[model samples]
Every structure is written in structure tokens, then in C-alpha cells.
Target chain A: MKNLFISAALVVSALSVSSCKKDDKDTTPTETTGTVELNMAHRWGMGADNFLLNMELVHPMTQDTMTFTTFKYYVSNIKFKKADGSWYVHPESYFLVDLATAGSEILSIPNVPTGEYTDMEYTMGVDSLRNVSGAQSGALAVANNMFWSWNSGYIMVKAEGTSPNSGSGSFAFHLGGFMGSNNVVTVKTVNFAGNSLTVTGGHTSEVHMTVNPAKLWHSSASLATTSSLMMPGATAKTMATDFYGGIAFDHIHE
Target chain B: MVVSLLITSTNNNHSPLFDRGDFFQNMRTILFIVAISAFLFSCKKAEIENYKEWGFEKPSHFPEPHYKFENNTQTYDRFDLGRELFYDPILSLDSTISCAKCHAQTHGFADHNVNFSLGVNNTVGKRNSPALSNLAWYPNFMWDGGINHIETFSFAPITNPLEMHETMTNVVAKLNASAHYKEKFKKAYGSETVTDQKLLKALAQFMAMMISAESKYDNYVLGKTTFTSAEENGLQLFKTHCASCHTEPLTSSFGFANNGLDSDFTNDLGRGLVTQDPNDNGKFRIPSLRNVALTYPYMHDGRFFTLNQVLDHYSNGIVQSSTLATSLGTGFNFTTQEKQDLITFLNTLTDQNYLANPFLSEKKK
Candidate 1:
């Protein structure tokens, strides 16, 4: 028991040291630059309930009983606007926001020169360039299973779940199209509601966003009518537009 | 992980190397030994593996390749790993079919005497497996040119239910599970973890080395050999009739064309499905005709089994369509003698060296 206590104390010390290292990383920002984190707080429809996976929920619009098994989407090409009309573009800004994967909602934007940022610009789906750039790593890796093999394009947004109201007893919607008239990739700008986020050195500022997953069916039919949409077309574009449009910048916690 | 060990050894920690003092010193010695052995093991492995030094060389006759092996730099080991992966059936869901099942080495890396190659469970595919050669020169892949990257080409077939019937995740998992594959991947990519990107890049490396440039026609172009009268006549005929689409040297411009295949394209929209343009209906990529004699069963659908049938289609069997190649007006009026001469010219394009390249063949267990 005494040895066990000692070992436990060692583990606790190690954990605390590791956590302190992370705290240092976040707090002790470089003199010239600071980190800005975009926290995507996922929510349901008009009721504003927490949107989570593997939990039974009723669709606000479709009135269909649904349980999402997987909900993954791509958010990329982050850009921040300065007070002087100049924008700081993040290079290689790509992220796969998976509901099942913890902490994926936080998009960390690093190496921003300390300044007053007026607006946040980000892409809802992967950029057209990355979709055509072939095999990628990190969030865009093929292992993520977010790419269409035969047709050659990334699945911009995917929502797989089970629903009792569906004709097939399951729902799978993969929305993506990066080329031509049917392209579903949208570049959305969040102007912080006319407010400015002041970023100073040795600090981390956050832009909290509200992403409504239920907005996909805001303008579409119920699960019984259309349970699955696996490819790109008019239906995918509509669903993507609805979902992407629902994502709004609520406020900034500086 | 290996990187950390390397950094530790290269650091200022040498007192324990020559000491047998305590557990800490012993731990340091073990780490040093492990790092040294790892370095020596890799060196020994490389020394034992008798592979030709790899550098993607575009043939002097051919123009600069479209994919000049950027992003996917090739070494001999990477090519070797790719060759193994290509021949291994592990890419298939059931381990019953491999890329080599459809793309045989002897048949210019196309299916062997079959229009549609069998996949897992003997399920057949729709389109013919096009011969893979000089792929480093191809800017786009597949019949419809939907795939634009060489690194991502294998994903199409590996995941196609009518082909390998495997998911990229499962394939990577299976590769990661196997000790042989893990070691191969480690030797090739510096990590035991097998990823889709690494797998695809390795395959691309092997493809970059598949240079088919030593044919009789290539010799003729180089002024090393003189073509027969029939070959010369056939070359002239090909230039006049087919050069606009199936351009010279590479024998393809890599553009899409309807080619008068059909009037109605409801079954297969071809390039139209990718672009969503009605004008591109029934249009397929203009395939390279390198080793045309060996790569029989021509066209995207493998409708023609022989060069004669292909020639016949060009001569008389032109199915008129709104999206048909405007260059291919009605049909050509080639006689039997001219067809024979064209066949001779195509036969001269069969590079014997490319077919029997020992480096590309499967490594025996």
C-alpha cells in the first residue's frame, strides 16, 4: 500500500507536469504573436440543444427520430481580417471536425501577429485546390474515409446515422463537390457582429461559433422521403448550403 | 520513435556508454545499442537488397512527363515496396484479387485476354483495365479522366466494388497487421505505420519507373533503325487519321473524346458525370497506344478484341453521335492491305524490354 501510494504520487506528479507544460504553451505566447482558437459549439435546431453523436434525438423540422452514429465534416482555409482591411491567411489551414473525436471542435490558429482582428473568414468545406491535390495527410488523410475513391473528390461533409422514419432504417448523407456549377464549398465570413477581438502577446483569444447540425433538413424532405444522398448533385448542394449557412459567429471570448 | 532514440544518442550522453555502473547507465547503454543496431540493420538491409539505383528518366524521344514524380520522390526501395503491394492480394477485401490479377505484366499491365477482369468473388467490372505504361506522363487517369493525380489512382480500383472491393481503411489496417508489410513499409517510408498516402505514393514510385520507350518505332524515331515500306505507309496513315487525338511519341494527347462509340449514353455518361456538361457525354480519355499490339482489347469498354476490329471500327463502324469526335468524320476507307500495314506499325510499338522488366516483376517469397 505504501509503494502503491508512492507510485500514485509519481503518476500524479507526471500528469501535473505534463499539464503544466501544456498550460505554459497556452499562456506563455511569444512576444510578437498570439494564438486564436475558434471553438465550434455544435448545437441542434431552433431549440439550441447540444448536438451529439450516438444519442437519440428528434429532428426539429423533419420530425424524424434519429441517432447519429458518425458526424464528420471538413473546415478549412481560415483567414482573419485586420482593422486596416488586410487579411492574415493561415497557410495549410485544414481541419476535420469529427463529433466522436474529442476536442476536434477547437480550431487553433497560431502565429498571428498581435493585433485587433475585426473579422474571421473560413471555408465550410475543403477548398477546391485540396480536393484535387491528391493524397493528403493530417485531417485530409484518406484513412479518415472522407474521400470518394471512384469519382475522385473529398467528401466535404458526412452524416451517418440510424432513423426509424427512414425507408431503409438508416441515413447516410455525404455532401461534396468542388468543381463546376455543383460545387458545395462555401467561404463564410464572420464579422464578429461589429465587435473587434483584441489579441495581445502571452494570451489566447477564442471565437465561439454555433454550428447547427439539424439545419441540414431545414429545407429538405424528411428521412422517409430521402434517407440517403451519397453523391454530389442538387440535393447535396441544398443540404450543404443549409447546414453551412446555419454556422454563425456568436461572440468572442478574449 | 526512432527519431527520438537517434536524437538521444547524438546528444551529450556518453558517460554511460563506457560504464557498467547503475540501472540508469545500463538503460543508456541499451538505448545506444538499440540505436546503433537500428542504424546498422538499415544499412545491412540496404546492402543486401540488390536493387538498381532509381531515378525517373524520361526517354529522350518522349516529351517531358506530366507527373515528373513531384511530391512522390522515388527510391529503389520505394519502387520495390510498390511492386510488392501491386502483386499482393491484400489490397482486396477477400485477399482473392490483386492489381496484378487484372493488370498482368506480360499483357503490358492490362487484363489477360479478358474484356472485364474478375474481382473478389468472381464479380466482373464494367470497363476494361487500361494498360499502365509511361504513367509518369499522364496528367489524368481513368477512362473518364475523373482522377487527376497519380498518387490517388490506386484508390479508385482498390475501393471499386467490382474491382478490389476493399476500403482504403481496411487495406491500411491489413497492411499494418502484417509483419512483412509493416517491415516493408518501414524500410520504404521510415515508419511501420501503413497509411493510404504512403501506399499510394509507393505505387506512384513504381509507376514512375515503368518507362516503355525501347520499341522498334522508338528506334526508328531515334534513327537507329529503318522502318519497312508498310510501316512507313502505316505511320503516314496514322499521322493523317489518328494523330490529332492519339498524338505521336506518347501515342495520346490525354484529352477526352466520344470517338463515335454510341449515340445514347444513359448507361455510362463517361466524362459528363465528372464535369456535369452535356457536351462531354460519352467522352473518354484518349489512351496512350504504347505497346498497342500487346495491350489488346482496345478502347475504354474493351469492345474491340483485336487491332483489326479497332481498325474496322475506325474504317466502317463509326457510330455517329452529337458528341462524337469532330475530327473523325464519318469513317476512313482503309483497305485490308492498309489495315495489315497499320497492324505492322502498331506491332513495332511493342517494347519487349518493358514487358519483361525483372525489376517490376513480383519478388518471390
Candidate 2:
């Protein structure tokens, strides 16, 4: 029993030594770290109404009647700007925010060092590096049906639904391109606006960000015009930019 | 025969039996793990003691591999699992087409003279199915070089509409549903729940082992055999004319080249579709000339059925294009004797041992 206890202690120490070398190293073990949840409160355009699947709604911009069956996109490379002027960069940070999956909208950043953060930054879609890196696990796994197989790259933003405006009676917008001329991968930043987040130990801070799905057709045409986009191009870039650009940081709960 | 002797001599101690000797030496340290395994009732000891026997090892002549087995480490269980998956039709939507259907071992891992391989539900594919060997050494995969990694290569065929026409989610679900696959996955990765990464990594494990370095040319390179006068002259002529893009040792630099296959780029843009660069419009992957004799109907579209026809194309049939490879300058205009000699040299690249290796073949149920 004594030897077992000693062995268990040894195992714990070994695990600590190994985990210290892991890629998800934003803070050291000794540092007092706090968790931050970027609660993606999905909303519609213009009036910012409730955005839920299976619910029929008219697009504020395109005015196209649509009922979404699936809406999923990638959020990756989360970072926090420290008050002292440095950045707390999280490593291997990737999340698939799917409307159907429970708790997927909450982008959780754990083990963030306790500090006053003035800004939060994240890539709207997956980075080009992870897209070309091959088979991945967790939120970036191919099993999630987010990654494109034929032409390599993540399907950065996918919005599929049954629409009356569609010729096929259904629409699927799979937007992604991490290459030259057509790259839609853009890094977005949200300023606290002097309402800085106090990330303290033992308390989980939540940041509510309103995501307008209707903005996908803001600059682009209605579903009646271009019903589907399977691959990335100018149309994919325009629609993705509109939706990603319109995302606003609503509020924060300390 | 000499190739197997050299490889065995170099890696004789990599057998699983060697681990047993290390086991007794480190028994005191790993006693806790053993006790825990006993408590869990899963004795992994029965799992092949050595997968390192089939671990990725570069040929003495070849350059360093591009895929250094980054995440998916070499293991027998993984290779076996991959082999099963490679030959299994469950990857297709209706379970009709397997990877082996297109890439067969007897034909140097290429289809048997089929220009375009038939896929699931009698769907004919677009591009000619290319031969696969020494894949670990390849920088990129497919004729277009679109797939950047070998681990992700299987995904393209599985999800392609004209190919397997299956979703990754559905494939994973199918794998999880199979008790045989679940057991295989458990033995390979210690997990009953099979994920796409595991599925891909397992396939890569089998593919990475598809090294074809036992050909007569390899033997000649290793100083184990001699080439005839025609083969020797052909080798020198090849070095002077074709060795720039179709480089030595691996027989390919794995670079993209518009080998003057076509003048117009309206139908298939080839590499341009992936890069979105019009300059790369007609360029396709300059394929390895290894096993060129068996991998016919040749070229990206299987345009040439015979080696002589391919030679004639390179010598007399090169079309003019902006993206044409600067290396291929208006046909070689090879003499009849020179063409015969070159074909003879190409025939020496057929690795019969690699083609007939029992380990790579599908396990009979």
C-alpha cells in the first residue's frame, strides 16, 4: 500500500512533467489561471432576433424566407490582449460552433492567466496551417464533417437549410478557401471598450457575442439567385466576410 | 532476393521478441502498469510484440521521406487495421468499392489497364487512377497534388461524389458499428470508439509501408546487380533528357509540370484549380516513373496504352502551351533504337517483390 502510494505520486509527477510539454500551454502550472467562455449568442440580422434552427424567418437583408437545418462554422486561434501590452496567445485553439450541438457555441478558453484583458482576438475560420496539416482530433477532426476532403481545406462556414427561394428547395453554403486570391480566413478582434474583463481564479467569466447569421446574404444575392456554394470563390469570400464582419461583442459577465 | 537479405541484416533486431528482453529488465519500474492491466482484464501482451519490424525505413538509395510519420506512429495493429480498411468496401456509400479496387498490388498498386476506374454504383471517375508506392517519400498526393498529406489521401476517394460517395460522418458511424473494426481499433489505438483521425492514421500506417525499393534499378544502384548495354545507354540517355523532373532514386522530384498534355485548359485546369493560378493551368504532378512498365494506360488521363506510345508523345506529340514545362522542349525526337533502350531501362523498375508482398495483400477471411 505504501509502495502503491509512492508509485502513484511518481505517476502524478511524471504526468505533470509530460503535460507541461503539451501544446495547450498558455500558462504554467504554478500560475493562477482562469477560464473564459466566449458564449456565442447567435442572432439574426437588422433587429437581431432569435436565430434557431427549424424556425422559419425572413432574411433581413435578402428578404428570402428560410428555415435552417444546420449552421456550423470554425472559431480558432483565441488570444487575449493583456493590459500591460502583451498578448496571452492560446495554442492549438480550435472550436466547431455548431447550432445543433449543445454547448458548442460556448468557446471555452481554459487555463488563462488571471489578469485584466482589454481585448479578445480570434480567427473567424480555421487557419491555413491547420487546414493543410492533415488528420486532426477534437473540434478540428474530419469526423465533425467540417473539413473538405476533395479539395483540401476546412469548410470554414457552412449554412444549410430548406428555403422557398431555392430552385432545389434546399440551400447549402459551404464557404472556405485558405489559398491566394480566394482566402476567406480573417482574424477578428473585439475591444472591451473600457469594460475590461477581470479574469480571476475560481470564477468563470463569460463574454456574450451576438452572431448575425442573416449577414451571410448581406452583400451577396438572395437564395433565389445563388442557392448553393460547395467550393470557395469570390461569392464565398463576400458572404463569409459579411457574416464574420457583422459579429458584435454584446456584453460580458464577470 | 539480395534486397530482402540487406534489409533483414540491417533491421534484424527490430523484431517484437526484443521487447521481451527489455521487459524483464524494466519489470520493476512497469509493475504498476502490469497490475493495472491485470485489474482491467485487457492483456495487450497478445498484440504483436513488434510493429517496428514493418516500421518506415528509407531505402539506402532514396532521399528522406516527406511524411516523417508525424502523428501516426508505425505499429502492426495500425497497419493491419489500415489493410483491412483499404480492402473493405464499407468506406463507399453502398459498400461496393474499396481502395484496392483501384489500387491493386499485382499491377504495382495501380488498376489493371483501366483508363478511368469505376467507382461505387457504376460511377466512372474523371482522372486515371495513379499507381501508389513509396508514398511516404511523396511530398503531396493525387495527380493534382491537392492533398498535402498522405494521412488525408483516403478522405478524397471516400468523399468524392464520383468515387466512394460517402460522408466522413457516415464512414465513422459505420466503423463504430462494426465489432470487428472496433476490436481492430482497440488493438491498434486502445479505443473502441473509432474517430476519423484514427481511421486516417491507420490507413497511413499501411500506406507508409508501401515502399517499392526492391526493383532491378535499386539493385543496380546498390551494386547488387548489373545492367545490360541497352539499359546502361538508356540510363545515361534518361539522365540527359528525362532526369530533370523525373528525378533519380525515387524516379520523381514530385514537382508539378504541364508535360504538354493539352493546349486548352477549359475542361480540367489540373493544378491551376487547386492553386487558383492561371499560370499553373495545365500543370499536373510529374509522376514517379517507378513501375512505369506496369502502370499503363499511362499519363494523367491514361492517354497512352503502350510505353512506345508514351515515348512517341514525349518525342513527337508535345502540344504548345504557356504553362508547358520549360524542361520539355518541343519533343526529344528519340530514334527507334533509343526508344527501345529507354523502355528496357524502365522495365527494370518493376519491383516484383513489392507487388507480391504478402503483408501488403488483403488478409483472406
Give DockQ per model, in order. 0.51, 0.56
Q: Which ten residues in a row have the lowest lDDT in candidate 2 chain A?
A: A22-31
The local distance difference test score of each candidate is: 0.87, 0.88
Which segments of model 2 are wrong by more than 4 Å? Answer: A1-34, A82-91, A113-115, A162-170, A222-225, B1-54
- What DockQ does candidate 2 score? 0.56
What's the CA error at residue B89 for candidate 1, in Å?
1.5
Clashes of 1: 0
- What is the lDDT for A58 in model 1? 95
Give fnat of each prediction, in order. Answer: 0.79, 0.81
What is the DockQ of the complex in model 1?
0.51
lDDT of 2 by residue, A134-240 (tens): 79999988878887776788999999999999999999999999887689999999899789988897568999998999989888998898999988889989999
Question: Backbone collision count in every prediction?
Answer: 0, 0
Docking category of candidate 1: medium
> How would you encode candidate 1's per-residue C-alpha lDDT over A1-254 as one tens digit per residue?
99999999999999999999998886653577778999999998889997899889899888999999999999999988899999999988999999999999999988887999888889999888887776888889877889987677889999999999998999999999987766999999888646898788867999999999999999999999999988788899999999999999888988
